[model samples]
Target: MSFVLLVTLTVIEIVLLVLVLAIMVTMVTRQLRSIAANLARVAFGVRAVETQVSAIGPGVTEVNRLLRDINGTLPRVAQRAEQLAR
Candidate 1:
């Protein structure tokens, strides 16, 4: 009789431990899914920003060229102004 009671208690303890482990696994799985969804959204936003930056590249290059042209003429203009001052 004593042996039978001991076996029953051991089985109950094992069942409770398995139940607790299952709950923990389910909670972890839910959190992982949420993180995956947020990461996907972030990836989409990054791609959109990349597309916009690519579209602006040619305009930026044109502006830089214009600035370079102005920069090249500045020294001659300054020299002329100095001559006029004299």
Candidate 2:
């Protein structure tokens, strides 16, 4: 082949290779972005669960307080009933 033809072929080959690499890079970047978005959504869901679980402590505390109040009143009622029986 003539030197000029060989040089032209080489240039075309280089350009094609560069284009393919660019396309592959863009595809990979797109996939990475999608994965990052999914991970963010998962993180948000986890945070919501954490907030719900954290609230359970105070809820349980309120229930315990209500039970204690009810228990305290029962003893007084029992003592009054015994006195009446005497």
Candidate 3:
């Protein structure tokens, strides 16, 4: 009698433990899927940024060249202005 009751209780406990483990596994699977989707979106966004930067590369170089030209002429313009003031 007591032995049968003990065996039955042990079986119930094992079943409950298995149920709990299954629920945890299901929740973990869902969270992993969510993380994978977010990572994919981040990857796509990074690719778009790379494309835009590459497209702007030539314009950036042109602007830098124009700035250098302006910088070179500024000193001569300042000297001319000084002469005019004198």
* Candidate ranking (TM-score, best to worst): 3, 1, 2
TM-score each candidate: 0.67, 0.64, 0.68
lDDT of 2: 0.97
Off by over 4 Å in 1: 61-86
Off by over 4 Å in 3: 61-86
Quick one: best TM-score, which candidate?
Answer: 3
* Model 1: per-residue Cα lDDT over 31-59, one tens digit each: 99999999999999999999989989999
In model 3, the clashing pairs are none
* Clashing residue pairs, backbone N/CA/C < 3 A, model 1: none
**What RMSD, rounded to one decimal, does every model reach?**
3.3, 8.2, 3.1
Cα lDDT, all candidates: 0.98, 0.97, 0.98
Look at candidate 2 and tell me the lDDT of residue 61: 93
lDDT, residue 84, candidate 2: 100
Candidate 1, after superposition: displacement of residue 28 in Å?
Answer: 0.2
